[model samples]
Target: MIMKTEKRKSVEDYLCSFPEKQRDLLNQLRMLIKKTMPQMEEKLSWGAPTYVLEGRYCLQFAGNQKHLGFYTSPATIRQFQTDLKPYKTNEKNTLQLRWDQPLPEDLLIKMIQFRAEEVRRESLK
Candidate 1:
């Protein structure tokens, strides 16, 4: 049997607020996270689309004029620092994916998976 999907707010509304080009990219990113962690809670947090698991924030993604921002915990950033070194990042644990370059889907998937496990560990502590 086919299961119907319920519509989510805030994140959808936020994606709609962007231009088509950026909107498409944001949509793809959102879907990827949802596919990877269907049980995670999603909402608008800190002016971006955030995912939380078991009361702990797992990840967040935002779109900018020139790039997309992927936000996660500092531990994740440090853990993936070598792989993420090619991208621009900040001390706040955000990785910037430029509009001019291709999206690193594999790296992102790894980061999301890592964050999900981290969130789980946090909730247990």
Candidate 2:
């Protein structure tokens, strides 16, 4: 018997779809997320770059006309509500990063770490 497999779209392919300026920011975010958790899998989902750990979604990235969006869980958002005040957040699980605002590296690392742990914990249940 013969088996067939399909190739999946890579994160790099997704990043290349954006314009130069937006691509740069998306690349930087992708690198940061990779650095935070080297073991996570990167894939394209919902037309954006998404990171997953043990079959659980850890983070996602999207670009808009005005800002770059980093998405996580609502529980993670609530955990870092104070630090997120500088950026605009909507009912969805996103933290908007405008071009003018510097990326909050420390907070982002914390958020990623927390989400990774959360995903692991939930998977164990």
lDDT of each: 0.84, 0.83
How far residue 34's Cα lies from its native spot in candidate 1, in Å, is 0.6
Candidate 1 segments whose C-alpha is farther than 4 A from its true place: 1-9
How accurate locally is residue 50 in candidate 2, as Cα lDDT from 0 to 100?
A: 90
lDDT of 1 by residue, 40-124 (tens): 9998888779998988888999887678999998888998999998999986789999866767888888999998998898888
Quote model 1's TM-score.
0.87
What's the TM-score of each model vs. the native? 0.87, 0.87
lDDT of 2 by residue, 30-61 (tens): 89999999999988897778999999888998
